[model samples]
Target: MNELATKHAALASRFQALAEAVQDWDAPTPVAEWKARDIVGHLTTWLPEMAAGYGIDLPKVTGDDPVQVWREHSANVQALLEDDAVTNRVVQTSAGDQTIAQVLDNFYLADIFMHQWDLAKASGQSVGWNPEVATSIVEGMTPMRDMLAESGQFGTPVVLDESHSPEERLAALIGRDPAWTAG
Candidate 1:
């Protein structure tokens, strides 16, 4: 596996751990109206529609088993990243013609990195990510603050001190309270 594949696998592993640790699917998440299960649901739901644009068909998983749904979805996405034919194809996106690999790496992977914290906290499990990766994600998102807020997909960002950890900054920038904990 290459760098993108490796990153995807590592993020997926942490996500899977949180998914399996969900003692209550209905637990509230920092994402306003979402729950522990909705975190996985959000990821699984969006991926297929995005993959379809590249002529890739990802399986639609039911919510009956959120952990299994996440595992299967993650595996399928990883397989696509590993497949030369799939990853190499050029696809027309709003951003223009980008290889399927670029689309997956830039969007899907970033989404996973953001939501992992939500899932972990909601499930009453601690979570973290590579700081460099977290910083990179924050940098990419900073320029799109207006667009992100308008999309309603993200909440209004909170102000944080420079001394805050990158992960905390990430959570704050995404409208999540970094200090949030499960009840």
Candidate 2:
């Protein structure tokens, strides 16, 4: 498998694990306004629209079971990631035209990565994510911090003390407070 495919698979695994672990769909998340179900809903709502730009058809999620909805949509996305025709296809976005691979790397994968943390935090589940992945995402997105904040995609970054770890810093960079706990 290629790099993008590998990354997608990693995300899929995390999502699947979260699905199995979660017992409450309405559990609050660190995202403030979004609940556990809303996290899945957000992804289910976006996957099809993004895939459509690459001429890939994804099944619409219809059920109220957020886990099932995520499972179905994520499976479709994972299949598309494995297809060269889908991954290599160029698609137009607000940022201009980019290959599906590029979009996955720059947007979808990062979204999944961050949301995995959200899901875990909301569900009170622990996930041992690869440090390398977190570090890479942090390094890649740090330069765009101002733009992402301005775009309303992320909250204002939280100030971290020097004692914080890289992963904690990454979480803060993406507008998630490392100290956040689901109420």
Candidate 3:
């Protein structure tokens, strides 16, 4: 796979790892008061939202338990992923208008990169990402500057330090504090 596809695949791996790590994890943190389940729920919610931007009707959240909502939504997201139209086309949304390429570049790829860190901290698992993917996300997101400010409510501020690893620094620069520990 080329760099972009590789990055996407890597991010997909990280998201899967995050999902696995946090699946049984139960705790609360800054993103939401619920737990890691809620964080996954939120990501699951956005999956179809992105599909909607691509003109696909995805499952909607209408449940009390965030985990159940996420489970249903994840099923929809999985189905959408199987559909070429939803995955291959880009569409605009309340977050920001982006082409499919840009969405994959910025949101689908980068958002998940950062969210891995978020999920890691919230679940007490290592959220470390490969440097190449981190660098790619940072570079891609640079042009879409405002997207972070708009939909970044869930991300914690990434704290920078000269001694930090490239991935850690990249994470911090985007809003996640590498040193953060969920209480």
Candidate 4:
């Protein structure tokens, strides 16, 4: 697999691990109004739509089991990423038209990575994510912070100390409070 695909797969793996570790799907994540199950739901729901733009048909996952749904959908996304043809295809996005590979690299991959942290924080699990990836995401999102905040998809940005890690900074950039807990 290419670098983008590999990174997405790694993020997916981390998400799966967090899903497995969770004892309570009802636990609230740092993302306001989203629970542990909702984190998985968001991924499973959007991935197939994103794949559709590349002419890929992913199987529909049913049932109340969020982990199983995420597993099924994420596996389909991984399979699509493994195909060079699918990755190279151009697709229309809300931002504009972009290659599937670009979308994966800039959007889906980042979403999954952040959501991994959300699930972990919600479930009281620890994740050792790649700092390089977090730093890169922070850099990429810095310029888009206002637009994203205006979209209502994200909450207001939380202030954090400069001494915080890149992952925490990235979380703040996207309007997530890194220190948030279910309590």
Most lDDT-accurate candidate: 1
The lDDT of each candidate is 0.84, 0.80, 0.61, 0.79
lDDT of 3 at 178: 62
Angstrom error of the Cα, residue 38, model 3: value is 2.2
- Tell me which residue pairs clash in candidate 2: none
Model 4, 87-178: lDDT tens digits are 88878878798888898777678788877888888988776778887787777677777888898877876545569998788788878877
Summarize candidate 3's per-residue lDDT along 2-59 as a digit string, tens digits: 4555555555655675666564456764354656666666666775676665666877
Residue-pair clashes per candidate, as listed?
Answer: 0, 0, 7, 0
Clashes of 3: 7
Weakest 10 consecutive residues of candidate 4 by summed lDDT: 153-162
lDDT assessment of candidate 2: 0.80
Given candidate 1, what's the lDDT at residue 148? 80
